[model samples]
Target chain A: MSSDVAVQIDRVGKRYGRHWALRDCTLSLPAGRIIALVGANGAGKTTLLHLAIGLMPPTEGSVSLLGTPLKPGRPQTLSQVGFVAQDHPLYRGFTVAEMLRYCRKTNTRFDQAGAEGRLRDLGIPLNRRTGRLSGGQQAQVALTLALAKQPRLLVLDEPVASLDPLARREFMKTLIAAVAETDVTVLLSSHVVTELERICDHMVLLRGGRVRLAGDIDDLLAGHRVLTGPRVDDAALDGLVTATHGERNSHLLVRQPATAPTHPRWEAHPVNLEELVLAYLEGQD
Target chain B: MLWVTWRQHRAALLTGLFLLAAVTVPTLVSGFAMHEEYRAAGIAACLTDPEARAGCAQLLDQFTAHYGQWGNRMIWVTFLPALIGAFVGAPLLAREFENGTWRFAFTQGVSRTRWLLTQLTVVGAAAAVLALACSVLFTWWRGPLDAMSSPMRTAAFTVSPGLVALTLFALALGLFAGVLLRRTVIAMGLTLAVYLTVRITLEETLRPHYLSPLVRTDAQKAADALPPTAWVVDEGLITTAGNRLSDGDERKILQQVYDGDTVREGGAALERYLAEHGLRHYTEYHPADRYPIMLIIEIGLYLGLAFALFAAAAYLVRRRTS
Candidate 1:
C-alpha cells in the first residue's frame, strides 16, 4: 500500500450471530479523494464504514487507518478518525454550545472556535437546545463536530439520508468546502446514487456484503460500454459484466478497454454513473 | 473528559441537588420542633433513666401523640434510593444507546472504558454525597425517636448509613439494568423491582438471622420479660419434658384451672396453670446494643451487591456493541 492510502482492509469479515454483515472485504482507499460507498439497503456499506472507524471490530482479519492498526476502544486510533453516525446523533438536551464544549473537552486537538464559527455562520443559536433546532441545523452541527476534531480521515454513514433536497444540497456544500479547506480523506456511504456522482471522485460499489466494483469513476466508466446488437442466443460478448435481451436486440454492458464495437451491426454508447452502478448491481443478482 | 461528563449530566446533577434540598429543609424544621417538645415535656430524663420512666409515662404519651404522624412520614425515605436509581442512574447509559449517541461518544479521543469510568465516578460520587447528607441529616433529626425505641426500628433504620449503601446499590443496579435493557423507562422499572426485591427479601429473611437471638428460659415468670427495648423474635411455653406445650395443652390446663372460664377471661388462671404444670417460658430476643453490628453487616451486604453490579455494568460496556 502507498503512504497516501487512507484505509486498508485485508480479508476483513464481521459476523452477527449466524449472519455475515461483511465478508472477506479487501480494499485500500487513497487519501485526499472523496470516495462514495454505494450499495443497496442491506449491502454492508455501514458495516464497512464502521469497521474503518473502529466502531465495531471485525470477527476476522485486520483494518488499518492511515497505516496505523485500528483497534476499537483505543484512544490513539480513535483520535485520528472522526465519524458521523446515521441520523447524526447528538445530545438532545444540551445547548449547541454545550455540545461544542463537550467535543473540545473529550478531544485533544478539537478546534472549538472553528466549530462555533461554522454554526454561527449557519445562523444556529449557541444557547438553544439541540433538540429545538431544525434537522438541517442539527446535521450541520454534527458535521461541524466531526470537522472540529482536525481528523486525518472522516467517515460518514448516510449523513444526509434523512434530509430534504435543499438540506442535502447545503450539507454537500459544507462537506465540499471542508474537503477543500483541509487535506482530509472522506469516505461517505449512501444508498442514494442520484446526488453522489457530482461530488465523488472514487466509487466502491457493494452488493450483498461484497465489493462488486471499485475504482476511479472516470476509469470505471471508461472501461464499461453498452452494446446494442442483433439478438443471438449463441453469440458471446467479450468482457461481459451483464447482458439483457430485448425483443429485437440484446443489450450488453461489457467491461472491455476498447471504446468501439468490432461488429458492423452493433452500436456502442458511453455509460452514465448511475447506469454503471445499476448494471453492476443487477448483474450480480 | 470531566467537562464533557459534567456538561452532559449537569441538569441531572442539579435536579438531584434540588431534591436533596426539598427533603432536607422540612426535616430540619420538624426535627428542631420535635427536640424542643421532648425536652419541654421532661421526657429526656425518663428515656435516659429506667426508674424515671415509671413516673413519665403520661409525658411520653403526650410527645408520641404530637409527633407520631411525622415519624410515620419518614418511611418515605426508603424510596429515595429507588428514585435515584430510576431517574439518575438508569438514564446514564440507556439514554445514550437509545438516542444513538454512544456512537458519537465512543468515537471521541477518550476510550469507552475511560469514558464510562469517568461518568460513573463523577455521577456516583455525586449520588454518594447526596446519600451521605440525607443520612446524616435524618439521623440527627430522629435522635429523640431513636431514644424512645431501639434504633433497629424500621423508620430509624431507613436513615442510617445503611441507606447510603442502599442508594449506591440502587445506582449500580440502575446502570446494570440500563446496559442490559438499553431503554430508560424499562431499565428504571427493572431497577426499582430488583432493588425492592432484594431489600424486602433481606430484611424479612436474612436480617433476623444475622446473629442468633439470645434465648432465656426459667421456671419463674420474671425471666419471661425481655430486656428493655429488645426485639422479641419468638416465645414459647416449654414443659419439664423439654417439649413445647401446644395450644391444646394450654387450653386443657386453663380448663382445669379456670373451671369452665376461658383463659382470656382470666389472665391469672393461665399463669397459675403453667406454674403448677412446671412449664417455663422461653424468650428469644435481640438486644438493642446489637444495632451497630447489624448496621455494619447490612451496609456491607448492600455495598457488596453494589460493587458486583457496578462491575457487571462496566463489563457489559466494554464487551457489547451499540
Candidate 2:
C-alpha cells in the first residue's frame, strides 16, 4: 500500500486442481528498484510472475500493480505494467520493426523512438523477422519490446535463458543501464543468480511454492556466513540462523552477531546472492 | 485499426488467390467449351437442346446455363471459397499461437483481447470479399441457365460472399483449435472438422428448415410437365402454376427434368413461389429473390461461431503459460 510500492502481493497462491504451484507467497516490490526472483525448476517462479501480471487469477490471494489490482485488458493497469513470459512469444511473420510499430499503435505509453534506439544499440536488425533469428536473438527482440512499453513494473519470467553467455551478459548490461536510468521497478525470475548479482538490490527466493527468504540483498548477505570448523555440530549452531547445513564442516548461515568466544570457531564471510540463495534453499530442506 | 488486421493476414490473401484459380479454371473450361451429350434414340443427344446438332453442345449450354442452374451454380460458388478458406483460414492465427507469437502480442501494450479481435476482423473481411467475388461471378456467369435451372426466384443465394461467413466460421474454429492444441497440424485438423461438421449440418438437415421448405425444380415447360392428375388428387393437392420438388424429391425432379418440365418443392412452398413471382401455370420457373434468405442465415451462423471461438482463444492465450 506504500506510494512507492510498484507490486503488492498479498498472500497469493496458485493451484492446478489439488497440486500447489505457489502457496502463501507474498512480497511488495518497491518502485525504482530491481528485484530478482531466483528458484530451481518447479519452484513456482513463473507462477508468481503470471499472478503479478494478472494473466491468471490467484486461487486464494491478490496481486496488484501501481496501487491498483492488475486486470487483464484494463487499460490503465496494463499501461503501467509490462510482462515477458518465457519463450518470447512473438508473431512470426512480422519483422522486428513491424512488431514495434504495432506496439506503438496499440499502447498509449509505447515509446517508438526509445525501442528502436535500444534495438539499434543491441545490434539487432530492425528489419529482420524474429522467426528467422537464433534463439538468443529472438529473446533480445522480446526483451526490447517489453522494455519499450515504458512501464512502472516489468515482470519477466526468464529473460535471458536462451542467450549465449556473451548475449546474456550484453542483455543484462543493457537492462541494468535502463533500470539505473529510469524509475522502472523490475522483477525478473531466473535460476542464474550470478547474472542478477551485480544489479539486483532486492531478492526473493521461492521453494516448493513458498517464500524461503525475501528482503534487501545487502542485509540478507551481511548477517549470513559460511561457517567452517574442525567438527562443528548443526545442533551446536542452533542459536544462530543456519540458512543451510552441509555434511562435512556444515556451511552454517547465521543472521545473528557471534559472541567473542564463538568468533574464532566460525569463519564469517560475505555471502554472494547465489550462495545466499543456495544456503536458504538448503536450510528450508 | 481494421487495416492492422489485413497486414496480419497477408498469407491468407496469397493462399486465397490459389484457391480462386482452382475454382475458376474448371468452371471456365466446362462453360466456355465442351458440349454435354448422351446416347438417346440410337444417336447422340444433348440434355437441354437435344434437337440442335452442332454449334454449342448441351454441355456448353448447361455450362452456359450458369445462371439457370441455381443449386449447381451455388455448389460451384461456395466450393471455391470453401477451398480457399480451408487452405488459408486453418493457418491464419493458428500458426501464430502455435509458434508462440502470442507472447509478444499479449505481453506488449496491446491486450490479448484487442490483438485477437483485430485478427478476426481481418480474416472475416477477407471471407466477405471472397464470397462476394464468387457470388458476383457466378450470378453474372449464369445468365443463360436461369430460365431452365432456376425459374421461381430471380436470385438464388447458395454460396455468395455471405458464404464467406463459412470461412470466418472456419477461421474461428482454427483459432480456437490453435489455443487448445497449440500446434498448427492439430489446429488445422480441428478447424477442418468444425468446418465440415457445421457446414454439413447447416447445409443438409438444419438449413432446409430455417427458411422452411427448400425447393428445387427442372426448367421444363410443356403439357408433360404436369404429374398425373390422379397423383395430385391423391395427395389432396390442386394443380398450381409450377411443379414442386422437395428435398425428399431429388429423384422426382430428375424424372420431371427428363420429361422436359419444371419441378418445385413441397406443394405449399411452390404455390408460394408461384404466387410471389406471378408465374401461374408456367412450364419452367425459378424465382431469384429467395437466394438472399439463404445468404443471410449463412452469414449469421458464421459470424456467431467466429466471435465465440475468438473469445475463447483470447481467454486461453492470455492466461496459459508456455
Candidate 3:
C-alpha cells in the first residue's frame, strides 16, 4: 500500500479452462526501478504481466496498480500503466504519424510533440506505413507510443525476443534513455538473462508458473554464494539453493548473509546474476 | 474513441459506400425511365376505373411483362445486408483479434467497453443509413410494378423499411460471430450462412402468417372477387360438406373438365361441372391495407434479433480476455 510500490500483485492466479498459467504469484514491484521478469517460454510471464496491467482480470486473487485495485477496462488504472504486448502489435495500414495520432486520440496524456521528436531523431519517416517499417523501427515506434503516454508504470512482455542483436541493443538504448528522463517504473520480461543483467537492478525469475527467486540483483548476489571444496554432502550447509559435484570436488550455491561464517576447508565466491538465476531455475527440477 | 473506430474501419466503410453508389447510379437512371413509362402509358387511370378493367388488364400485363423481371432481379439486392455483415461487421472485431491489435487498443486510456460501444455505434449507424437509402431507392424503383401486383410480396418487401432492420440484424450477427470465432474469414462465412437462413425462414415460411388471410367462397368463380392489390395466398375448390379440395384433386378435376380443349367455352363447362358436384371456389388473400402492419411486424422481429445479437457480442467482449 506504500506509494513506493508501483504494482502489488497478491496471490494472483490465471486459469485457462483446466490449466493454471499463473498461480499464487505475489510480488511488490517498487517504483522508479527497472525490474526484469526472467522466464522461459510458457512460464506464465505474459499472464502475470497482463494481470498487472489490467489487460485481463486475475481469476483467483487481486492486483493493485499504483495503490488502487486493478480493473480491466477501467480508464483510471489503464491510463496509469502503459503496456507493450509481445511482438509490439501495431496497425499495419497506418502510417507512423497516424499511429502516433491514434495513440494520442486514445490516451488522455499523450506526448505528441515528444513522440514525434523521438521518431524524427531516430530517422523514422512519419509518412511510412508501419507495415513497411523494419522490425527494429517498428519496435522503436511501439516503445515510443507507450512512453509518450507518460505512464507511471511501463510493462513490456518479451519486448526484444524477435529483434536481431544490434536492433536489440538500439531498442534497449532508447528504453534506457527514456527511463533516465522520467520517473516511470519498468517491468520487462525476457528469457535471455545476460542482456537483462546490464539494465535491470531488480529481478524475478519464474519457473513452471511460479516465482523461483526474486530480489535486488546486488542483494541476491550478496546473499547467495558459490562454494567449492573437497567432495561433501550438501545437507550440512544451511540455506542451500543448488549443488553440483565431481569426483574430486563439489560446488554448492547457497543463500546466506554475506558475512556468514563458512567451513574452514571451503572457498566461497560471490554469485553473479546469471549464475544465481540459473542455479535456482535448475534447482527446481 | 470515435476517431480510433473510424480510422480502423474507414476502409470497410468506404468500400460499403462504393458499393452503394455502384448499385444506386444505375438504379436511379432506370428508375426515372420506368416512372416516365408508367405515366405515359396511363396505367394509373386503368387501376381506378372499374369499367376500364378490361382494357387496363392488357396494359397492366404489358407493363408487368416488360418490368416484372427487372423487379424480380432486384431480389439480389437482398444480399446487401449479408454482404455488409460479412465484410464490414465480421472484420470489425475479427481483424483486431487476428492482427493482435486488440492488445494495443484495449490497454489505452479508454476502457474496452467504451471502445467497443463507439465502434458499434459508428459502424452500425453507417450500415443502417446505407440500408435506409437502399430501401428508399428500391421502393421508388419498384413503384410501377407494385401497382400491377402487390408490394406485400417477397421481391417488393425485401426493399421496404424492413430492410433496415434486417441489415442491422445481419451486422449484429456478424459482430457476434466475429467475437465468438476470432477469425475474420470464418466469421464472414458463418455470418452469410446464418443471415441467409434467418432471412429465408422469415420471408418464405413466416411472412404470410403475420395476419390470417381473408377467405371468400363463391358458387361461381368471380374474377373480381379479390381486389387488384390483394396478395393471393391460396385458391381452391370447397365442397358443401366444408371440405377443401387438395391442389392435386383440383388439378385432376380441371383436366377431366377441359379434356385437352383450349377454348373459352371450356371454362363454362368446368364451372357447370363444379356447380353440379356441390363444389364452390374459395380464395384466401391479404388485402393491401395489411402492408403497414406486416411491415411493422417484420421490422420488429429483425430489430429484436439484432438487439439480442448486439448484447451477446458486448457480453463476449467484456468476458473474453484474449
Candidate 4:
C-alpha cells in the first residue's frame, strides 16, 4: 500500500447464507484521487461499496480506512469516508432546508453555507421536501449533502443514476468542484464507465468480485489497444499480449508497452473507456 | 435536533393528535346514553317507557359492539405513534446512509459515534414528546369513560396507556429496527411486530392475571345464604380477617369462634350473623379501606410493566445497526 493510501483491502470476501456476494477482492485507493469502479449487475460492486462506506464488515480478510481497522456500530471511519447512496434515500417529509438543518444538527461537520449554496446553485428549493422534488433534483440534493461534508474520501454509489444526462453532467461538475475545493478523495461506482471516464483519473474494473484492472486511466488506456483486421498469425504479434478476443473477426485487444507495431495486417487503435470495460468484462467470463 | 424532527414530522404528529381527538368519540357521546343506562342498570329498571329503554339499550350496544374488535383496533392503531416515530425517527440514521449526507457530518470533524448519538438524541427526543402528546390525548379520551364504569375502564385500561407505551416503544424499536434492517419496509414491519406484540400481550394476557384470585361468582352469593355451619361443611375455605383485623367490623362480641385456622376462603362468606344485643363481628365492614390503596397498586403494576419494557427498549437501541 502507498503511504498516503486512504483505503486498503486485503483479500476481502463477503457472503449471504450460501451465496457469495464478494470473493477474494483486493485493492488500494490512495488519497486525493478519483477512482471509478465499474461492474455489471449483481457483480459485487455494492458489496465492495458497502465495505468502503463502513456499513458492513467483510466476512473474510480485512479492510482498512485511514490507517485504522474498519469497524461497525461506530462511525469513526465516517469522518474520513463520506458515502452518497443510490437513489438519495432522504426523508420524504423534510424540506430541503429542513434536510440541511437535519444534516447540520446531526453532524457537526456539516457546512450550512456550503449546503445552502449548493442547493441554490442547483435551483432547488431549500423549503421543498425531497419526496416532492423531481428525481433529478433529489439526486442533486443528495450530492449537495455529500459535497457539503467535505470528507477526506467521498464514496458515491451510482449517485447519478436518477439524473438525466444533462443533470448528471451538471451534478458531476458540482461534485468535482466540491471535491476539488475540499481535496476529498473520490471513489465512485458506476455501470456507466464513460461518464466516470470524463471526471475520474483512475479506474477499477470489477468482475466476479475481483479487481480485473486498477490504475491511472491514462496509463491503462495507453497500454491497451484493440487489434482488429484480417486474421493474423499469433507469431506476427510475438511481442504483444492479447487481453480479449471476439470470435467474429478473431479480433484481439492487446496490452503492450508503448512501442510501435509495424504490422499492416492488423489495426491498432486505442480503446475508449467503454471498449476497455467491455473487453475486461468480456475477458473475465 | 428535535426541531428538525418536528419540522419533518409535523404533519404526521398533527394527524396523530387528530386521531387521539377522535378517540373521544365514544366518551363524548357516552353521556347521552350513559346517565339513563346507569340508572337502568345500577339504580332501578325504568323499562316503563319504550323510548327510554331503547335509548339505554343503544348506549349499552356501543360498549358491546366493540368488545370483539377491541383487540384488533389496538393493533391497527399501533402504527399511530409508530408512524410518527418510525417514519420520523428511523430516517435519523438510515437517511444519512442512504443519501450520503452522512458525509457532511463526518467532514465537520465530528466523530461518527457522536454524530450518530446526536441524531439519535435529537430525533429520539422529538419522537418521545410527540408520542407522549398522543398518549396523553388518548388517555384523556378514555378518562371520562374510565370514570363511568370501573370494569369497562379495566378493559379500556388494556388500550390507552398501553398504546401510549407501545408508541414510545415503537419509536425506539423502529429506530433500532430500521438501522438493523436497513430497508424501510422490513424495519417498519419488524418494529411494529416486536413493540405491539409485547404491548398487547402485557395488557390482555400475562399481566391481567385473568383467573379469579378468589373465584367468587353470583352462585357463590347464593351459596352464602346457607347457615355458617352448613357453609363450613360445603365450603372448603373462609376469611375471618375482617372480624379480627378491621376496627369497624369489631363490635365487642364473638358470635362464633370454632375455626381450626383463623379462616378459610369460601367459608368466610357463610360466617355472616345477625347481631345479638346489636353486637357485630365483621358484619358492617366497608370496602372503602382498600380503595385508595388498591388504586395505587393497580397504577403501579401497569406502569411498572410499562417502565420495564421501555427500559429494555432503550438499552437495545444503542445496539441498533445500519
Candidate 5:
C-alpha cells in the first residue's frame, strides 16, 4: 500500500449473521482531501466506515489506516483517527466541561483548550449539560471532540443527516475551516450527492455492498461523456456506464479518455458530477 | 482513565456517600443511646456473672422488651448492599449502551478491557468501602443486642464485616446483569432479585453445612442450663436404651405417668417419673465463639463469587460486538 493513502481496504467483507453487510470491497482513499461516500440505505456505507476505523473487524479481508494495519481499540490507531458516528453520541448527563475533561484524560494527544475554544466560539457554554444543547450545537461539540484529537484521518458517518439546512451550512463551514487550518483527510458519507458536489474532491459510490464507482471527482467527470445518437449496439461504445434508448434514438453515458466521441454520427456532452453519480447508481438497477 | 471514570460516575458516587452519611448518623446516635441503656441495666455484668444473672433476669427482660425490636428492624440494612449494586453498579455499563454512547466511549484511545476494568475496580472498591462503613456502624449499633442474644443470628450476622463480601458480590452481579441485559431498569431489578435469592439460599441452606453442629448430652444433669449464646440446631430426649424419644412421645409418657395431672401440680412426681424412665436431654448446637471463623468463611465464599462475576463481565466486554 502507498504511504500517502490514508485508508486502504483490500477485499474486505463484513457479515452479520447470514447477511453480508459489505463484500469484496476494495478502495484506497488518498491523503489530505475530502472524499464523499454515497450509497443507498443498507448499501454498506456505514459498514465500510466502521471497518476503516477498526470499530468492527472484517470477517474475510484486511484494512489498514495510515500505512499501518487497523486494530480496533488500539491506542496508536485510535489516536491517529477520529470518528463521528451517525447520531453524534455524547454523555447526556455530563456538562460540556466534564466531557472535555473526559476526552482529555482518555486520549494522550487531545487538545483540550482547542476543543473548548471551538465550543466557546460557537457560544456553547462549558457548564451546560450536553443534553440541553440543540442538535446543531451537539454536532459541533462532537466535531470539536474529534478535531481535538489532531487525527490524520477523520471519518464522519452521516454527520449532517439530521441537521437543518442552516445547521448543515454551519457544520460545513466549521469543517472547511478545520480542513483549511490542518491537513486532515476527511471521509464523510451522505445520501445527497449535490450537497457534496462542490465540497468533496473525491468520491466513492457504493451500491448493493460493492463499489460501483470511485475516483477523483473531477477526473471521473472529465473522463465520461453523455452521447446522443441513433440506436446502436453495445459494441459501438468504448466504455458504456449506462444507456437510455428509444426506437429511433439513444443517449449513452460512457467513460473514455476525453470528453468527445470518435464517431461522426454521435454528439458528445460533458457530464456533471451529479449526472455521473446518478448514471452509475441507476445502472445498478 | 481515572478522571474519566470519576467524572462519569461522580453523581452516583456522591449520592452514595450522602446516603452513607444519612444511615451512619442515625446509627451513631441510636447506638450511643442503646449502649447507655445497656450499661444502666447492668446487662453485661449480669451476663458475665452467673450469680448476678439470676438476680438480673427481670431487669434484662425489661431492657430486651424495650430495645430488641430495633435489632429486628435492622434487617433492612441487609438490603442496602443490593441497593448500592442497583444504583452504582447497574448503570456503569447499561446506560452507555441504552443511550448509544458506547460508540463514542469504546472508540476512544482506551481499549474496552481498560475501560471496563477501570470502572469496575474504582466503583467496586468504593462499594466495598461503603459496605464496610455500614457494616462497622450497624455492628456497633447492634453490640448491646448481640450481647443479649448472639451474633450467629441473622439480624446481627448480615450486618457484620462479612457483609462487605456480599456487597461486593451484589456489585459484580449488577455489572454482569447490566452487560447481559443492556437495560438499566431491568438489570437493576434483576440484580436485586438475584442478590436476594443468593443471600437467602446461602443463609438458610448452605451456611449450616459449613461445619457440623456439636452435640452434648447429660443424664444426671438433664435440666442443666446450656450456654446462653449457642445456636441450638437440634434437641431431643434420649432413653437409657439408646433410643431417642420424640417430644410428643415424651410428653405422652409424662402425661401417663402423672395420670393426667399438670407438671406444676406434681413436680416431685414428674422428677421421679423421669428418673425411673432413665431419660436425658441431648442438644446439638454451633458454639457462639465460632462467630469469627464463620464470618471469615462467608466473606471468602461471597468474595470469591464477586471476583468471578467481575471476571465474567470483563470477558463479555472484551468479546462483545456492540
Candidate 6:
C-alpha cells in the first residue's frame, strides 16, 4: 500500500495441480531491512519468494512489490526487484566478463563498474568461464549481478544451501557487505536458521504452507520465553506454544511479554533463535 | 537481448555455418563442372530445337548418365531442415530449462516475452538465411538436370525456395517441442520425428493430387501424347469395353504377346492384336507448366504451419510459470 513496504502479499495462494503449495499467505515486508524467511524443505518458502518476485502469478489474491502490482512479464515491476534463484544459475559457457556484460545489457540501471570492482576485489578473474569457477565464486558473481541492478527489493531463494561451510561464510560476507552499502530490502529464505540470526533484523517462520510466526527478531525473542515448573496440566499455563513434561517437572515454551507476571514456583529463561524456530516447527501437528 | 542471444548461441550458429560450408563447397565445385558439361554438350539447345531431336536424345541420354546420380543424391539435402530443427531449435529453449538458466534470464530487467521473442527472431533469422543460401545454391546446381526431368519432382522440389519455409516450419516445431518437453534430447527426437512425418506425408500422399491429372486416350500411342518433362501419374491400355487396364494386367498381356517371338515381329503383331481388340492407350500426367503453382502451394502450406507452431510456442512461453 505504501512505498515503505517493499513487498506486500495479500491472501496469496499457489496450487500445482490438486496440491496447494502455499495458501492464505499475507505479509508486508518493510523497506530497507534484512528479513530472514525460515522454513523447512517443502514449507512454501520458495513458493512465497517466487510470488513476491513475480516469477509466477499467484493462483488467487495479489502481490505487490514497491507499490506496483506483480506481473510476470512487466518490465517496470521486474526492474525494481532482483532475484537469485536456488543454485545461482548462470550461463556455464559465458566468461565472467561476458556474464557481467549480459547483465548490463539486460538491465536499464546497472552498475557495471561497481560489479567489476567487486569481482576484482574478490579475485574472480574476468576472463574465466563461469562453469570453471568454484561454487563460492559463482555465488559471489550471482550476488554481484543482482546487486548491480540496484533493485529496491532483493529476493534470494536458498542462496547458500549447497555451499560448504567455508564457502557459505564467504558468500555471506559478500552479502552482508553489499547490504551495508545499499538501502535494499532483502528477503532471503533458508531452511537453516543459525547463520541468519546475526544479520537479519526481522524473521518469518513458515510451516505446512502457513506462516507460524512473524515479527521483528528482538520483539519475537523478547515476547517468547521457556518456563520450567513442577508437573502441571497444559491448561494451567497461559499463551503456551509448546509444552514437554517429565514425571517431576515440565517445560513450556510460551508467547508473552518479558514483563508478564509468572507463577512463583516456575523459572523463566530466554529462548535462543534456533530453539525458538525448532519449537514452533516441531509444535505444528 | 540481442547480444545475449548471440553470445549464448554462437557455438550452435557457428557450427551451422561450418556445416553449410562443408556441404556447399563440394556442391559448388561439382555444380560448376556440371554446368560446363551441360553447355559443352549443347543439352539446352537440344531441348528447344525440334529438328535436332534425334541427336539431342542421344546427347541428353549421355549427359543424364554422366550426372543423373549426382542430382538424385541431392535428395539427401532435404534433411537439412530436420537437422536444423533438432540441433538448433530444440536446444534453444530446452537447454534453458535443462540448465536452469531460464530462472536467471527471465528475472532480468527485460520481460520474459521480450526475451523469448528477441531470441526467436535472431535464431529464426539465422535459419532463414541459411535456408535461403541452400535454396539458391541447390537450385542453380539442379538447373541442368531440371532441363531434362521436371522440377516438380522430389529431387529438385526439395531444394527450391520452398525449402526456406520448410526449414522454418521444422525450426518452429523444434522450438515448440523444446518448450513443451523441456528436455533437449527428447525435444530433438520429437522434432525430427514430426518433421519427417510431415515431409514424407506431403511428398508422398498429397503432392501429386494438388491438382487433377490430365488424361489422354487415343486409338494409338502417339509419340508426343505426353511432354518429355511431364510427371506421368499413370499410363495403360483402355479396353474396347472402356475399362482401363491395371499395370499388372498390361504387363501380363504384353508378356503373353511377346512370348517365343522375335522382338521386331512381336511388336508388329502386338499392334495388330491391339487394333483387333479395339484397345486404346491412355496416359495420365501433370504438365511442366504447373511447377510454379505447385511450389507456391507447398510453400504456403509449410509457412502456414510454421506460423501456427510459432504462435503455439509463444503461448506456451507466456503461460509457463517457474
TM-score of chain B of each: 0.89, 0.58, 0.94, 0.50, 0.88, 0.91
Rank the models by lDDT, top first.
Answer: 3, 6, 1, 5, 2, 4
Where model 4 places Cα greater than 4 Å from the true spot, the runs are A1-3, A228-249, A260-269, B18-153, B159-212, B215-220, B223-322
For B226-319, candidate 3 gives per-residue lDDT tens digits of 7778998888899999899998998888788877556367389889999899999998889998999999999999999999999999999887
Local distance difference test, candidate 5: 0.85
Candidate 6 chain A: minimum summed lDDT over ten consecutive residues — where? A1-10
Residue A164, candidate 4: how far off, in angstroms? 2.1
Model 6 Cα shift for residue B158 (angstroms) = 0.7
* Interface RMSD for all numbered candidates: 0.9, 2.7, 0.9, 5.3, 1.1, 0.9
Question: Chain A TM-score of model 5 versus the true structure?
Answer: 0.93
lDDT of 4 by residue, B13-129 (tens): 576557656765764465445444445563223233434544656554564454324323533455665575557545544555455544343433444455455555555555556
Q: Write model 5 residue lDDT over B48-94, tens digit each, in one string.
A: 88788779879988888877887788898888788878987787878
Chain A TM-scores, per candidate, are 0.95, 0.90, 0.96, 0.90, 0.93, 0.96
Give the CA lDDT, 0 to 100, for residue A71 in model 6.
Answer: 78
> What lDDT is reached at residue A271 by model 4?
74
Report fnat in order of the candidates: 0.89, 0.46, 0.88, 0.23, 0.81, 0.75
Residue-level lDDT tens digits of model 3 in A119-187: 998999999999999999999999999999999999999999999999999999999999986789999
Model 5: per-residue Cα lDDT over A1-285, one tens digit each:
223899999999989999988889999999898999998898999989988998878998999998898876687788788889888999998888888887888888999878888888889999999999999999999999999999998999999999999998899888988888677899999987777986899999998889988999988988898888888866456688888888988888999867353788788888998888889888744
List, residue by residue over A1-285, the lDDT tens digit for candidate 4: 224888888899888778787888888887788889888877788788877766667889998887788875354556455677766667776778876776666554777897888788779988787889988888788777766666778888888877788988887888877876555779998887778878999888888777788888999888887777765455346434443444545466677645655467667677777877887776634
Give the Å shift of residue B88 in candidate 1. 0.6
Error of 5 at B34 (Å): 2.1
DockQ values of all predictions: 0.80, 0.38, 0.79, 0.15, 0.64, 0.74
- Candidate 1 C-alpha lDDT tens digits along B46-66: 877877877887887777777
lDDT per residue for candidate 6 within B75-133, as digits (tens), equals: 88788899989998998988988888888888888987898889989999999898899
> Among all windows of ten consecutive residues in candidate 3 chain A, which has the lowest summed lDDT?
A1-10
lDDT minimum window of 10 residues, candidate 4 chain A: A235-244
Candidate that beats the other on DockQ, 3 or 5, i.e. the better one: 3
